[model samples]
Target: MSANKAVGIATVVMVLCAWAYIALSREPRLPTSIANGRYSNGCCGTIFLHDGVMTVANQRVDYIIERDKAGPYVLPTAYVGASVHAVVVKFDAYPLKLRLDDAAHPHQLELLDDAADGVRYSFTRVNGS
Candidate 1:
């Protein structure tokens, strides 16, 4: 075999190997799974669900609870009384900017797991002073 022909074959084989490795290792993208009537600010954020638990990236510790029938209804109260695992994904410090949402304002959200029962009930703020 000619030297040039041998080199060409080797290059092609290397390229094919790299392509296969990337294709097989890539993770699947999650889809938006919020119910038709429910809303969430974390929609624009990344969510991960494992072992029947749901977690959102860049979540705020102080979350507001609101009502919407379309939502699956995970957390019912604003205080977050349960002993749940919470983390502050992002913040600027001093006058913290929390991510707040309700059925009224929705965002580009993704649902990591559909089977997880993360939320329990739905409660909206009282109307009128």
Candidate 2:
């Protein structure tokens, strides 16, 4: 192949490789809550697991206050115990409880903000009936 053609093919291959890597490695971006749901800020976010189903929530209001005094934001956490009843996982799938909280530790706001890719809410489940 000519020098120009070889260079062109190499460029195309590189682009294709990049695209494939992004498509395969990218995590799914899901909403933190349902519309009009009663959620306090910084409480709701996505739950990733090694097994079981993936889920998201808009409950649990642990917001991160930035050091620069910008604003607070929600972070996602796994729904366990009674809190699971409040959350509504997307696609009408019930969020099966994977475990229970052993201690009364405050939610980790900073981790949620840094890890969450979208807006956060207060709890995973909606309020009221």
Best by lDDT: 1
Q: Model 1, range 74-105, lDDT digits (tens) per residue? A: 33112221112332233333221112233334
- Candidate 1 residue 14 Cα shift, in angstroms, is 1.0
lDDT string, candidate 2, 2-103, tens digits: 999999999999999999998887333223321212322233334432122233353332211111122222222332222322334333332222211111
Q: How close is candidate 2 to the true structure, as a TM-score?
A: 0.30
- TM-score of each candidate structure, all chains considered together: 0.26, 0.30
The runs of at least 3 residues in candidate 2 whose Cα sits more than 4 Å from the true structure, single-residue gaps closed, are: 28-129
Highest TM-score among the candidates is held by which one? 2
Candidate 1 stretches with Cα past 4 Å from truth are 28-52, 55-129
